[model samples]
Target: MLGASFLKQKKALEWLSALFLFLLLREWLLPLPSLSDTGSISSFLYLVAGIILVDMTFRSHWLGLLIKIIGTLVIFHAAFVEISLFNPEWILQTLQAVSEDFSRIVNQEWTNMSIISRNLLFSGMILVLVSLLNYLVLEQRQGLWFVFITISYLAVLDTFMPFNGSGAIMRTLMIGFMLITTLHLSAIQKGFIYRGTQSAIWKTLVVPLMIVSLAIGVGYASPKAEPNWPDPIGFLQGKSVTGQSEAIRRVGYDTNDKTLGGPFQQDDTKVFTITTNDKYYLRGDAKDVYTGKGWIKSDKQLESIVHPKNYIWNDTLFSGLETKKVMAVVQAEGEQLPAIFYPGQLKGIEELNPENTTLTYDTISQGILTFNGAMQKDSNSRLFVERDDSTLIPTPVQQYMDHYQLQAEIPVISEKKIIAAGSNYPKDIEERYLQLPNSLPDRIKQLAEKITEGSNNPYDKARAIENYLRSPGRYRYETKDVPIPKEEQDFVDQFLFETMRGYCDHFSTSMVVMLRSIDIPARWVKGFAPGQEISRDANNNMTIEVRNRDAHSWVEVYFPGSGWIPFEATASFTSPLQVNYDRLANEANEFNIPASTEEKEANKPKQLDQMEEADKPVVKTSAGFSWGWLWGIGILIAVGVWILWKKRQEMYLWWLQRKMTQYAQDDFPRRFTLVLTIFEKMISPRYSGETLREYVNRLQISGDERQDLLYLTTIYEKMLYGLKEMEGKTRSLWQQTIERLLRQMKP
Candidate 1:
């Protein structure tokens, strides 16, 4: 009743609603901890406060003031008298409990806010914040400063408590909109923002409509890459680029979370967008340690941090000779903070932003890219790499020379299974992927053998098991009602026998354990799924939007020459059943791996130098001038110019964002001013005779395209002329829309 009545206090209602919107974003997006943890506690307190505030509002001024004073005194007296609010503890004990939760968080042992010592600490903070918000927004109308103050606090807080893509993006947008609301309300109160404009009412509607459109574009237009989560440990350790290779970092992501007993909770917030030459499963972090409870990231391997240029240019040093390259353009969804993800073995990574964020390579995982800090909003990166799935069926083997893999046929009389069986993995792979806890059940082994009864080789056995579980109607794909196994029952055992219900992690983890039981080495890998392909380019490049729900886990089985082969065991996401596997074994090709190597290389362009050398004809002339040469050079230059024109806006925006992230002050508002000034001078180039929108009008663009440009110009005017702050999400949209316009139209 109290929580419900708090809304009756008009002032409390406004700020409290805003706070709820911010808090509930977790439930909407990637809520790390369940809502029942602290969220519910805080909510309950809100209701109680609502009743009190509402009742007090109806009282006379003196009575209301006296009641508030009495309430305060009572609370203090109770604290002094050692009275417990929720538990048998005094105020000091509650404080100690909150302190313990913080310590657990710092240790990275606590699973977010789920099992905190006490809820009163956060509940109390929320109550105080809402009270202050009400006074500022309703009574004093001093909401703008408070809004900025909160945002600044969150940014610093985020370094300590990093948000997922959804959490971060939602936080930015909600706060931004609320800030705009407060600004307009305050302006109206002071005769500014909301004081009727001379433009048509429809003209005023343009910016809002533009925001809606840009929001949609940001959702679909960005490129999806591997998720780079926030690093709390890294943040605390040092701001330097150097760090160890922890498969799991402090990135607001913990796959080892114990979700065995409860329903699966998914967050569908947009993470990143991806555009690629060909669609394939993206490679992400890998976990080798299974502690019976959950996967733990151990083995802190280290490699020297390398710059983007060094990684790309010296490919032979990292990936070896004659490797296939899959080019991808990826966009991370965040404000100025971003993360990185990729598919297969990455040869190079090019960030659109200029932060010069160096990537650390996991010499162990080979393909994984690790960034030191969060990336900027609309930050795009290009990946030159190779995926593991190959058409050449790996030479199945149980025995091979230590140098690499060599084929041999093994015959077993038990089931008269005779097949080639000598595909060998690196020694390190065998040790890591084959490691299984003693608690793993025999049921998993029996099931693996039963599933692959007739299969005579590792590839065949692995494929048989994978295909069986992936077949529809056999195991349904779901995240809810997953049974929490008893203390003695293994997680895999429960899913395979009792529940028979699970999601990607369950399926993948089960598959890995089962394979290991049968002497087939496998490990678990995770990243966001390749989302809906929205558009395809002239070169058949695809654009996809990957969200939080798309985050997935799968199996990677190691094979020499083939690398770590990605296998999909999830029921709903299996690829084609039967494609000719041995067809891609090319004794003639330069690059290794079988399946998609030829497919990937066929579409890739030959080097210009090589092409020229191949096509060169003997032109006997005293002078070096030839009409053919002139024509070829002209064509190359035109193509280069065309490419540059198409990507110019993205290039500019990335450059601007990169600059903002690297600022010594990193004061967002100040950096925004500098960036906006530079954008106008360099990109739009405001002239002496033309108004901002007039300059755009001179382009003679009309209809939808003109509306988009006009919207940007309108926003620019408001931001330049009006005393409003640029919302983080809005800034991301502005950059995206401009880039979209540049790509769509010739201008």
Candidate 2:
């Protein structure tokens, strides 16, 4: 008879386990509401109750397994769909809407609530009442009615009251309630016996009494006024720009000045606008000479010269010119400078400079023309340049320049000097070129040598190095945790030998230093990478916004007949078409600057020679850090802490029930011989593996006794999982319980 009774008990427990597994699977499959939602909490309670009912009615393992599998499949399907369709933006918007509505209802006078507020209040009230009903069911099962009621009231008060403002107090109370309620329900379903000495009435009464005491304590605490809502615009305005350096630095061009900083900074000031019919290149100051550091105009002295007879110029003068091109006036943002960038070679500049508006040059080998002093605020600046379509034409020479004769006055250097500086190339360029700081690493030079081997000419060497650095096999853009050191010697060496991931600066700087070592007069050029091509207007004018992401740097090498040609030596593989003027113009606005008769006449030999002296190199400073990094780091740390706390709560609940089973088996020795038992009853072995603690936890207990079991279990789990030592009362209770249970269970 005893053996038969044991078999029946084991069968019942097995069926119960199967039912619990099925319920868990079902819950996972459905798109349940967030834990905080009242409706979701109610649904969860019903589901748990349903699982208990099913376990009582069905003892078949096959039926339980089938239900579990089907439920798991449903959940897996939902998870897949959720992952594919997840939109963070929608979640944020919903939270914002909920918060706003809640705030409005709370602040409004009861008699004067708006329609929206009233509706929201009514819905919230309904949820609260339903939640209360669920709490009652939980209390009945656990026999902790007074405790549940008191805790619910305290939580509701904390959520709605002005005390402590909108802080963690409310959230903590709600979480505590959830924990108590879930523990109560799980215990009742599992048939666990509570071993606590305290009666249910006393345990239930103590919670309400404690809540009252807390309410009294809070009333005695310091009083503060309600927090006012912040103005969204004002909040945005107060944000520090220094914190957003990368974002700001991306758009680093001053449309007005047509000059780029060797180092970029973030500023969103608009420059000027353009409305044009034909596509044109917005010419910044042309750089014809490259030092090891950066780009500059040609070294040759400017000579005054008459305008070439074959030149074609736009007709636009100061305000309005009848031209096929479009025109636009752009405004500046913050302290950002202004600039007008157009496609193609400029025909003439109008109202930019009184002394030299018309720029009619036959060709610019590698040099760019600038309207001096035209960057000043009140000065009317405009670039009239012809668009060059052969930007993609390959090496030694471009085909577009075939018809144009080389000017006699233009400086002609030997091909060797142009390719590799003369015998004095290293010595002459050492101070400005091969001059890495004493702190620069030896490995940087080694890498440079490795990349440029066998390349005889400056152009070929530079190209070789650029291709190697830019190849997909060499670099990626992931930010390194331990960044390459900024110390002179360590920076480049670390980048080349250790962490090979970095942004454009590291690559360009390395390229410049290497070229200088080999007698090449390569320099860094900083400007917007390339603006997006805007749609053209009816008249064929395109307007572009040179945003923050456009900031870029590259090397410019001098070519004999063509002036300076641009080459990107960084790891970024931006296509030439993306940055090319004609292609961009074809997609965006094309403005034509008309050449005035006086400007055309003024572009004589005398003027060209006179203006050449102004093309000399100038020095500038570097871009550095602001105050935003601190705040970003703080936000990251806070998010990490919240995740840890949530995980701790889950582990605690799993441990509580395990300990309760130990208390239940203290009176029967043979019946509790083992916490977990394995018996083979079929072809497939049926083996059950569970900890003594886990088996104890599976039984459902209620009221004061249930809380006691939960408390002990939670403490034990924390000790075991957290690797903490059992201490004081908890240690004593665990020792006594184990001794008593083992003594009783001995055969």
Candidate 2 lDDT by residue in tens digits, 1-747? 554422323233234333333333233212111110011122233333443443334345456435533433233223211222244533343345446556544663222222223323333332333223232222222223323443443333223211111232333343334334444434433332333433553455357547755775686465967547321222433533345445333334322322222223333343333333322223343333333233444333222122322334422111121112223333233333322333333343332322322232313222223332212111222222222542321111111110111111112122233343323343433334344445445566677777778765566677677766655446533211225354233444555567665555556656676666555655554454334334455544445454444444555554433333445555422223111112111211221011111123332221110000000010000111111211233245335434534453343323333544555432322222222211111011222465435544554433443344355455545544664554466556654654443333321
State, as a TM-score between 0 and 1, how close model 2 is to the true structure: 0.30
Give lDDT tens digits, candidate 1, residues 20-108: 33443233222222101111122333333552463335434455445544454344323222233444334354355457567655664
Give the TM-score (vs. native) of candidate 1: 0.39
Off by over 4 Å in 2: 1-347, 353-441, 454-456, 478-485, 490-494, 538-541, 573-747
Off by over 4 Å in 1: 1-261, 312-324, 335-339, 352-354, 366-423, 576-580, 583-747
lDDT of each: 0.47, 0.35
